[model samples]
Target: MYQSSTIINHIANFTSQRNTELLAFSLLKSVNSMISCLSTKIITVNKKGEVRDHLFFENNHCTVKDNSIEIDNVLRRSFEHMHDSSLAALTLKTKAGYSVIRLLHHDRKSEQFLIINLNEKMTKENDYILSGILSIYSNFIQLLNESQTDELTGLANRKTFDSAISSVFNTRPREHKEVDSERRSPNEIIVKENHKYWLVIIDIDDFKSVNDRFGHLYGDEILIHLAQIIRSNFRNEDLQFRFGGEEFVILLSADNQMECMQILERFRRNVEEYQFPNLDTVTVSIGVVELKKETFHITSIDYADQALYKSKKSGKNQITFFENMLSQGIAKKSDIQGGSVDFF
Candidate 1:
């Protein structure tokens, strides 16, 4: 059995991890080590009670694909029960094992469920201790989300981008693991040799004109709506950020240059087709650069920015690849270095 002091110290260490996913995994591992009686998992579910991502500490783990039938049935029952009465905590026998489920957090829009597969039936004292641990974990997650998420769009903020990009460069491509299966296929996974990371900077075309023509309140609505479109167009595993002031950033993994170009082109076309209320056609300019482990981080960002500048100069609503720009003799290395380069 773990002492109270030991559990507190372990949770304190969990709060120091770099990102939300890492923090969640670390917390689960710590809890499993401290209390061997229960194996914990954190599952993210959408408004319709569909299991989106499942994180676990187990062997031969069941994923959304592998257990879709069972998961859907379970979620259906849970939701039905939730409608009748509050399901703050409940226990039942599942196909896999005996489990306890708790509503870690919920709003009108989304919910996160905490599922514990019990190794043993708990005593009264054990239940009390487990409840306390869940509260601690919940509070930690709330604070982390508040810090890392953008208030307006709910996308990742700039600080998260800084840490995520640095970690990507420093760590070998092999170190990045696969996320949920619903997001991407096995072929699209990020592996060091096969797939390379690409950075794309997206700028809203004539955004300032829109802000001037309409009120700032409507301008903010456009920003939020565009953010939603960006999220829908990219995979869940991809890193996205509202880099500030109508400029956004996307980091994606692709097998080749053509694939990268195709992806960006698709997004561009989607943005062009979407209609915005009481507004003229809205468009975007994109600059893309293939990120290499050997390249300086700031240089890569600058290259992407330069490509964006080139896109703006040539036309407002096109995608430009940095390597293509070099081949076309449109930009020189000195020109990229000359641009304002700053990091946070």
Candidate 2:
């Protein structure tokens, strides 16, 4: 049996977190504390119920091994079974042992599930408790997501970017190195070692003219369409933000400068080719900078902005890198003093 005080404490702890990733970790810790499970993991899935990625995982014993293929197979089977029935939770036997899978939440973008591996079947009381906890967790997540999301674009709001960039600095290394494919799983898309964080600022070229000619409503529609394009082009793990009115920011990881350039150039080309309502064509100017662990967040933004300035000056609908600008003697580093650089 679970204690009321212990449950209440876990609820309070998770609810107190302002960051979504921190909240996920707290939720896993709470589940581990209350349940007698061998391991617990929170996995993200698409609308079709295919497992896309793992958010958090905790193994309680040394004997348990983390197998991505086995987990995906089990989840696929469990999802199919759940769809065929009216069950809230499903218990299935795996090679390691029995596992319990429950749909924690389903949002507009994706669905999240909690999978717990167990040595034996859970008791009725434990199952009931787990369901109740999940209910609370789902509610909290919905509320938090709304607060952090951009109302118009549905991307993360500017305030959320402030918190996310700090995490990038904390986790990524200062120096860049070559990616070692031998050490990484063939299935893994994001390689942590030698990977670098990139910050790109994208601005719709002459967006003010579009608003002036077509009206604010049409301009808003363009933003929405652009956001959708952004979602389709980038990975689900990438952090996208709307810095308000024609400007957007993307934070992603790439193995090297060449890879990063390719990703950004592809996005640029997509934007150039997109057909917009009441418009002949739409184009965007992009500014990119590789983030170093020791660099201040403000300085990084300034560097990207300087590169953006170069793009706008040379002509719009282009991509520019900060390092390239410095090497070519086109841009200078900022003093980090207050005030904005006038573009017009």
Candidate 3:
């Protein structure tokens, strides 16, 4: 029999978490406590239905197992049983035990699954309880996504930028040996050793003029179109944000300035080539800086802003690197005593 008080406590624990990763752990803990299971896992898959990452909890402790082949096999089997209309959850009898897999959430970006391993098949009572827990988890995830997302573009908003960069700052630089295994997919471009996090600021050039000439409705359409272009050009792992009104920010990993330049330049060229409604052409100016552990977020943004100022001053539709500007004596360190730097 499930204790009402215990279930209430579990709901409270998972709901209290703000971070998605922490929330996932709490959800797993709650499941483990409520069910008589050998192991539990939360597997995340991309839109293509390939496993992106997973968290495995077994024997009351979290662990990592390099068993991709086994995971793939299990997924393949699960897919086979997914079409059974009467089966609320996919149940498979494996060599180790019986496993129950249920869809926790699904969206345009990704899908999440909850898998529980038990010595015996899950009872209907357990399945009912599990459905309740999944409902709560799914609702929490939807709320979190709405809170972090931009209303206009549907990209992440400025509110998420600080925490996202903090995650980058806290990550230890991976070694050469780790790079190969760290890659999520063969097509992933940003996975490399000795790579650094890059902070990019993209501004729509003369966007105010666009609003003046074509009206705010057309201008909004352009922003939405540009956001779609961004989603297509960058990998899903990269952090893309709409920082309000014609300004956007991206945090990505790259081996060096050259690679970063290639990536950004390609984006710039794409923006230039794309035709917008009632406009002949639309272009963007970008400023980029390397995100360092020692640098404050504001300082990093200021540095990129300085390069952006140069780009707007010289000409529109150009890319500028803060390090390049500094080396060329075109830009200097932001002086707090001089007051805040203004963007044009």
Q: Write the per-residue lDDT of candidate 2 for residues 262-304, one digit (tens) a residue.
A: 9988999998899888788999999999887666778999899
Residue lDDT tens for model 3, 1-344: 79899889988877776656556767787788888898998887665556666777765655432224136765755744563352446878888889888877766776677889999989889888888988898889788878889999999988877767755643423221122212222112233456787889999999999999879988899999999999988876678999999999988778889999999999999999997777888999998998876677788999998888888988979999999998998778756522454569
Writing each residue's lDDT as its tens digit, candidate 1 over 179-240 gives 43222321122334556789999999999989999978888998899999989999866788
Q: Give per-residue lDDT, candidate 2, residue 305.
A: 91
- Summed backbone clashes in each candidate are 0, 0, 0
TM-score, model 2 to reference: 0.80
lDDT values, one for every candidate: 0.73, 0.76, 0.77
Best by TM-score: 3
In terms of lDDT, model 3 sits at 0.77
Residue 250 lDDT, candidate 2, scale 0-100: 91
Tell me which residue pairs clash in candidate 2: none
Model 3: number of backbone collisions:
0
Better of 1 and 3 by lDDT: 3
TM-score for candidate 3: 0.85
